[model samples]
Target: MSFDDFYHAHFRGLVVQLRAYTGDVAQAQDLVQEAFCRVFARWDQVSRYDDPLAWTRRVAWNLAHNRWRRLRTARAWLLRQREAHVAGPGPDRVALEAALAVLPARQRRAVILHYLADLSIAEIAAQEQVAEGTVKSWLHRARAALAAALRDTTEEAQDA
Candidate 1:
């Protein structure tokens, strides 16, 4: 099917799928558009897939997840910083963001998927294609790192 036809046929369903994956309706709609944009950008290549719709859905889901990770990370950092400033003796956003920015990719993804996206450990494992134990380990490490980051942020704020 042509891109236009695909867009018309699958738009709503894709949005719903993305929403389920993201746990956010607005992000899902944005991801649906982004998915179509990607499909059109590589139409020649992607169209050859036997099940292009599924391919698009997969890509869109990944995009939605990536966007969520980025936006939420930034927002969380900012909120922490703002709170730190208001608390007059707390962690700052910059220190926290820098700390979180250093996490290994899998640890970061596991943490975001579980806590921010409200996904279960099993769900995160399936989405990330990792073992559930791996996801759990990543989560444990991420939580430890977050605690350390918060401490560093507070220390830095105090020193400032």
Candidate 2:
């Protein structure tokens, strides 16, 4: 049979079979189309075979298997990326967070903006609509309070 005749006769059957194997009509269609493209490239040799349909079917199945393997590997890599291999928050972090929570709102904001956000005193003062001196004062007080709180927590932990 002509290549066109062979394709028209078997395309639907191939897609149906691939869909049954993959459980995805779109993927099955893609696999079948790709398989046809490969056969079209070597139609002369393929047509001589007693069972060209078997060769086409095998190619499509291999395509589906390869896609599944690649997807499985990618899924495993993504899962690894999501997993947190590093340790959880230690005692020092917990103590620091607790200490920060107890401070006044202004002090907390100033400390976070200055240290965590890497904002300069002038930038923080401009953002907070306060004088630079006022920003410095907040940071100084916050530092002292945080130091005292962390020290107390450490002492308590040591005592316990």
Worst 10 residues of 1 by lDDT: 83-92
lDDT (Cα, 0-100) at 70 in candidate 1: 96
Q: Candidate 2 lDDT, tens digit per residue, 42-138?
A: 9999999999999999999999999999999999999888856778899999999999999999999999999999999999999999999999999
Q: How far is each candidate from the true structure, as Cα RMSD in Å?
A: 18.0, 9.2
lDDT of 1 at 75: 96
Judge candidate 1 against the unseen true structure and give its global Cα lDDT, from 0 to 1.
0.86
Q: Pick the candidate with the highest TM-score.
A: 2
- Candidate 1 lDDT at 44 equals 87
Question: Roughly what TM-score does model 2 have, to 2 decimal places?
Answer: 0.53
Per-candidate TM-score against the hidden true structure: 0.48, 0.53
Q: Which candidate wins on lDDT?
A: 2
Cα lDDT tens digits, model 1, 62-124, are: 897788799999999988778444444333556656777889989988877897899999999
Q: How far is 9's C-alpha from truth in model 2 (Å)?
A: 0.4
